[model samples]
Target: MGQLDGLKTVVTGAGGGIGAAIAVAYAEAGAAVTVVDINGAAAEAVAETCRGHGAAADAIQADCGDLAAIDAMLEQAASAMGGIDVIVNNAGVTRHAFILDLTEADWDRMFRVNAKGVFFCMQGAAKRMKAQGSGRIINIASVAGRGYQSSSNAAYAGTKGAVLAMTYLAAHQLGRFNINVNAICPGVTYTEIVSNLLRDRAAERGVTIEQMKQEAEKSIPIRRGNDPEDVAAMAVFLASPGARNITGQGFNVDGGLINS
Candidate 1:
């Protein structure tokens, strides 16, 4: 049997990028999955991909940053999948601006979606998991959380730092219930988000996107950018029974970008 056989999982931001990859990976590992996204079409698309992989899958569209909406989404997801064994809090947003140029609205928006959204989603999922007496929560954080990066905005880093903090707090609070809480700090993964950043940077540098990407890859010790699937593999491992003894830890999958 597959490692995740008989498991039920919910992945937020499942429409694209790392979230989509995680959802697909979980399904491939023999888990029923719920693909949640703010975009209905995107959620459905990912759900279809999961189903195509022979895993039971459903889609739910909701604003993850809103507590009530997240509750509703989880309810719908759990109902569709029968129950939830794992939750991947992978939804996040970034407002790229220098500290001097950043506004209150920018900071607030980043926290709302990146930090607050993850908190409420984890709370709602933990409630269900607590009742069931077992579950796993894997949050997607970033290397920016660990230190300053010239390319990333300060607000984004701050929000990811909050995610790491939440992971630790949640692990402590939920360990009694057999719930595992962990965070993955990914480096420059080759997702649409990074693609867009590369495109913009290329424009700024008067170079092709490919050239910009190559230049960026040099900074990573791995000598190449990460694929979304690399991080997805970590998420799947963390969600499996093998990782039950591990909790409250932030694993960095950033191609050795931050060696701490």
Candidate 2:
């Protein structure tokens, strides 16, 4: 039997990137999945992929940054899937910018979707799982939160750091209810977000995108950037029975970049 057999999972920001990978991974592991994204068509496409993988899947388009939308998204998912067994909070955004380049608007946007959205989603899912007596919550953070030197921007890092802090607190508070809360810190994953950042950075430095990518990979001790599946694998594991005793921690999926 699959590790997550018969489980019902919801993946936010699942239209693409690390979120899409985690959603597909959960589906492959025999879980019913709800794909949540701000983009309706993109959500449907990923949900279709999950269904093609032989799992029951649905799509919901809702802005994670909106409180009402967050509540409604969870309601719709629970209504359709019967219950939520696990939730992967991956709704995040960032851009390529230095510290001085960051503005109030940047902090507001990142915090809304990355920090606030994650916290409320965790709270909403925990309330449901508390009654059900068991659930897993995985927050997608970034190595930037751990003080990665090459972070795209300070505001983005702040948001992720807030997620990690919440993850720790949620785990302790929800443990009695049999709910697990943890965070995944990804580094240089080969996703569209990183691609766009790289493209822009390359232009700024007058380097080819490939050259920029190579330089990034070289900085990692493992000498390669991560695939979205790398993060997905950790999400699946965290939700599996093997992680029943684990909670209140941040797992770094970076390539030996942040060895703490």
Candidate 3:
């Protein structure tokens, strides 16, 4: 039997990158999944891949930054899947900019999705989970939240720091309901977003993409950047029966980038 057989899962920002990887992994492990993203076509494409894995999957296009959208999305996902067993709060936004260059819009956008979006998703999921008597909520944070030196920007880091704090607080409050809350902080994961950022940086520096990637890996203690799958593996494990007892913590999938 698959590890997550019969589990009902909702993954946000699942159109691409780490979120897509996690959604596919859950489907492969036998969970019925709802793929949520702001990009409708991209969400549907990933949902198609999940269906190809022989698992039930639905795609919903909604912006995580909007509360009304979040409510509707959760309602739709729950109705389609019968009930929500897991919620992966993976929707977030960021841009590479110097602290001085960051604008009010940048901070607002990042907080809208990264901090507020994640919290309400957890709150919404926890409400259902409390009634169900069990659930798993996984937030996708970043090493930037732990004060990583080379974080993309101060505002982005602030948002992730909010996520980490919420994860811990939610875990404590939801534990009695048998709902597990955790956060995964990834460091230098090679996703489409990272690739795009690297592409822009490469153009600015007049270097090959491969060289930029290698340079990016240099700061990692293991000298390796994560594939989206690395984060997916952790998501699967956390949602599986194996992680039922694990909660109230942030697990860094950073290849030893930060000691704490």
Across 1-260, the per-residue lDDT of candidate 1 in tens digits comes to 77899999999998999999999999999999999999999999999999999999999998888989998999998888777899999998884466798898888888998999999999999999999999999999899889847446888999999999999999999999999999999999888878777887788889999999888888888897789999999999999989999999999998888876
lDDT of each: 0.91, 0.95, 0.94
Candidates, ranked, lDDT: 2, 3, 1
Q: lDDT (0-100) at residue 103 of candidate 1?
A: 90
Q: Is candidate 1 or candidate 2 better by TM-score?
A: 2
Count of backbone collisions in candidate 1: 1
Model 1 segments more than 4 A misplaced: none
Q: RMSD for each model, in Å, please?
A: 1.1, 0.6, 0.9
Model 1: what TM-score?
Answer: 0.97
Error at 118, model 1, angstroms: 0.2
- Whose TM-score is higher: candidate 2's or candidate 3's? 2
| Deviation from native of the Cα of residue 78 in model 3, angstroms | 0.7
Report the CA-based lDDT of candidate 1 relative to the real structure.
Answer: 0.91
**Model 3, span 153-199: residue lDDT tens:** 89999999999999999999999999999999999998877887788
